[model samples]
Target: MTVWYPQIDTSKCSGCGECVIACPNHALAVVSARAVMVIPQQCSYCGVCEVICPTSAIELPFLICFASSDNNKDQVS
Candidate 1:
């Protein structure tokens, strides 16, 4: 199973609550004066939080998979 969520960089976070407020899914929150992922399961991976962070604290890591021709041939067999 693949899970997609925003990664909050606590060091860069300004605790401005921008990301938390901008989040449509309400997945992030301010905890201990830092941004934390609260409801990870509710996150829609829409990248809104990453874009709204003024301090560049939020990041959405994506897993890119490339398909090789050889691998495709093996699967077809």
Candidate 2:
């Protein structure tokens, strides 16, 4: 399954590191004077980053898929 991730708007971001600090999963970081998704896989798709961002540079999609089961348990053949 696919997962949603945070999208950083560098134009709005001032590299304040607030999102980085607010991230509970340590998925965000400031690199070269810009906030970036250092560990995309570690992100929990939490909105804390978006909320904590003073510039509103962080945008996390509403839906985040964590698990999926393709196994058909009730196949009517």
Candidate 3:
């Protein structure tokens, strides 16, 4: 299974810690002047970090899925 989490582009990151502070799940942290995903499992796939990033460094690569009425189960398209 593909895990969904925030991806921080170190090159674009400004070490502003905005994403870290904005994360409601406390999943991101600034380490050595770069933002890192400290707890991937805690991430809720919310776009707060990505939206809060000033440099557009953080990205959440979540798979877009839909539920099928027949099975009432999530289906990845």
Give TM per candidate: 0.83, 0.77, 0.80
How far does residue 69 in candidate 3 sit from its true spot (Å)? Answer: 8.8
lDDT of 1 by residue, 15-75 (tens): 9999889989998899999999999999999999999899998999998776558857654
Cα lDDT computed for each candidate against the true fold: 0.89, 0.86, 0.88
Quote the positional error of residue 1 for candidate 1 in Å. 1.5
In model 1, the worst 10-residue window by lDDT is 68-77
Q: Report the Cα lDDT for residue 32, model 1.
A: 93
- Per-residue error at 21 for model 3, in Å? 0.7
TM-score of 1: 0.83
Off by over 4 Å in 3: 66-77
Q: Regarding TM-score, does 2 or 3 come out ahead? A: 3
| Model number with the top lDDT | 1
Between prediction 2 and prediction 3, which has the larger lDDT? 3
Q: Could you tell me the lDDT of residue 39 within candidate 1?
A: 94
Model 2, 12-45: lDDT tens per residue?
Answer: 9999999889899999999988999999999988
Report the number of backbone clashes for model 1: 0
